[model samples]
Target: MPTLTSHLTSHPQTAEAYTRATQSAFLSLAGQGRLPRPVLSQWLSQDRLYAQAYVRFIGGLLARLRLPVAKAADAVEWRVLRVLKDALDGIVRELAFFEDTAARYGLDLAAGPGEASENSSAGFGPNRVTEAYVDLFDSFGARHGGAQAASVAGGERTLLEGLVLLWATEKVYLDAWTYAREQGAGREGGKTGEDLDGGALRREFIPNWTSEEFKGFVDEIQGCLDEYAAAQGGEGVQDRALELWKHVLQLEEGFWPHVNLQDVASTM
Candidate 1:
């Protein structure tokens, strides 16, 4: 199968829009840096629970599959496993970061019910937005249970959807972190007892977003999407997939508006 980069490269407009939107979110923080810190802090703090829930859901689905972990070799099953594994690994590490940041802010990172908890709503706040988002994820998971070995050789739309979810979620976190760093540095005017210079402090607050680690991750995701786009067998499938990406791009553009960050400029 082709790599994600190849698929997205074939649709330059879509790929450019995706990159541009992410860059706008990143640069907005770099420019303003005057938005409220609590808005971003709250978001960074809640990410752990969301990551855990998503991980738990995916793990459950994977466990129900019959194929061996690495046995699928050249099929869609193998690609799905690869994507899921990569996502879960990142989520686990991010959960740890959330815990540390929560402690720094004197907030409880463990606000959500544990993974073993039966009630899905245990850790969630009273916000209708999060409820809607979580319910959608739960529904999506339930509807698309697992990748079957009998499916096509290349990966399916479900796998591409997963990659898109991973990319979009991480981008959201990065945006919040950059926004927080900018606001913190702007208000404090320099270092604010954090032992980091203004630019360094910006990097420190948002690990995945600002670090080399997540940039590489994003590159992999884009590559996967590019591959998916190239593997389309029919006009209907290709158009549908492109449309799905367009929807994702629009959703991402709308995401930051809900975070309630003050002093942040309009999106690019």
Candidate 2:
């Protein structure tokens, strides 16, 4: 079986897109300047809340697995879950910091915790493509016999699916963060006009593409992918993970174009 890097590196177009979206989202936050300060501040507040909920959900899934986070396999399948869990924890911490900052800047993002039923994070919104993607992950998770029921009898497939789910989430967070950043910096800049340091706003809320978190994501996930490929003794599972990763890459590549241009037109 080819190594995980071999499978992912072989699929240049998909990998490139994923990498690009990750960075572009960060840059977009830095460059965005289309909305009033108040609106952008509120958006940041709402986004942080969303992050909190997302991490909580991921935590629940990890808790169901009973897998020690420091497991021996840097296996792509296990790593996918571990990374997802790590991301959730990290995002939760980051959101708390962002909330305090947004509030200091006079943004009110206190939305009553809406039930996931009312505000599902399954997709960009209620649409055919997003709905399909959500269904795909749901099926993927249940495919291993509903989380707790399955054993290593089909662990490989479950891990690949989790990686796909990770891709989907990264794609969405990229979009949402881009939207929030653009809005935050859209205010006019001048004395009493909008004295906010837009760069500071971005730095506080958006993760730097070059930061350890982003770089580690590529390296670690790839490592996991490669490890899984080696253990499975085949390339089929690796290919599937790559395919799902592509779905997310494409989603992000096409995301900014769909961002509310009208909402942040001034900053664009």
Candidate 3:
């Protein structure tokens, strides 16, 4: 039986967008050791901001999972909760990596919305793409009572919806970096031909992203998502999952362009 992720990724439109995103020039340059330092710095800053929001998002998902269901004693919930807890821990480590990377690169860790911008030429503020992505996570967190209970004007989201979003986001991220790694390897003429042969962007960031441990983390999330979806099977459930899946791919596709084009006019 196909997992919900497989079903959604198999869709023609979704597949195309996903492919474009994984093969994006932003990632390609990073892999090839060609992405500018300013761009990488900008990305690190924006991603750090996103990671903070993600911690909140995961917290909300954990809260929802803790809610008593009919099968309150089932092992599935326990397993999923455990995975979310691990994810929370993983994000903390990831944030630490970001801070260390920023310090090593001389990138500003305080260049977000409220701070005086240092890399304005690289568009060092949160752009529309980051804003929209963060909003989606924040909205879901708010709806799920992770931090503060807020009214969702349209309607409340489901645990399944949140899980799908999480799965989609992580899956895309893993695949994108994997693609970058492969591309970088190919540019060197083979998978094991040579190291990235450049700076920290190649030596540290790419390997950290495409490492086996990171891949395992992504797989665990997918497994949790698939198990939940299988148990909660329904057309409506699948439909909603599919919608969120497509929406995430679309957002991811746009994300690369937004970050890469930060200094577009200056470059030209």
Candidate 4:
């Protein structure tokens, strides 16, 4: 029998979206050393915003969790709490890393979609794709019957679905960067970290995303997700997870901008 997560990826449409998201032309550009500085800035800025929203997203999930009593280390609830805590910690560090890297590279932390000034760090606020991600994160917390959200059945989404979403996002991100790493392995000037846009991505960010520590973190989330799914057992739970997985794939496919029209992704 396929696991919940594996079943989520079994759908042909879901698999295609995952491929579009993970193997986008954007990653291809980063690997080939052809990506422009403005595109990188745009992506970084949107990522920063996404990371910011992730804080509240985790908060919602934490609220939904019912922690086990002290020393219940083996409980699925305990494992879920630990997974969430680790996610929170990782995002905090990731946000700081973005700040430091942006400052060092002089890339615009405030860059937005459009013919953005590659030299200017202040462009605009969050773009459409970033806001869409924020909205999804907020959906876990949104009140029932809200204009922008309808996910709430009783009050908020189930912990099983939330864990599924968490797992899906991290899994897609890890695979996407891993693909980029493979493509960018031996490009000219990559070692010097100055090939394109300060080579922050091809050199620094890509390796960081594909790092052992990050990979371990992704694995932990997957383990936690499966644990929670099994504990929640039932065909219904599996169905919910699969639906949420498809939603995440759609968002991710739209998250990474298209290759040639990098800036255009943000506006839409």
Rank by TM-score (best first): 4, 3, 1, 2
Q: Write the per-residue lDDT of candidate 1 for residues 25-69, one digit (tens) a residue.
A: 434554334324444443343444456567755664455334446
Off by over 4 Å in 3: 67-74, 110-124, 142-154, 186-198, 258-268
Best candidate, lDDT-wise? 4
Candidate 1 weakest lDDT stretch, 10 residues: 148-157
Residue 192 lDDT in model 4? 42
- lDDT, candidates in the order shown: 0.48, 0.49, 0.71, 0.76
> Which candidate, 3 or 4, would have the higher lDDT against the true structure?
4
Lowest summed lDDT across 10 adjacent residues in model 2 is found at 111-120
Residues 86-120, candidate 2: write the lDDT tens digits: 67666766777776766665655653222322333
Superposition error at 264 for model 1 (Å): 8.8
Candidate 4 on 165-260: residue-level lDDT in tens?
A: 788999999999889878766665345454667677766788889999999998888888877787778757776667677777878887887655
TM-score of each: 0.59, 0.55, 0.81, 0.87
Give me candidate 1's TM-score against the actual structure: 0.59
Clashing pairs in 2: 4-226, 33-185, 33-186, 33-267, 34-186, 34-267, 35-186, 76-224
Better of 1 and 2 by lDDT: 2
lDDT of 2: 0.49
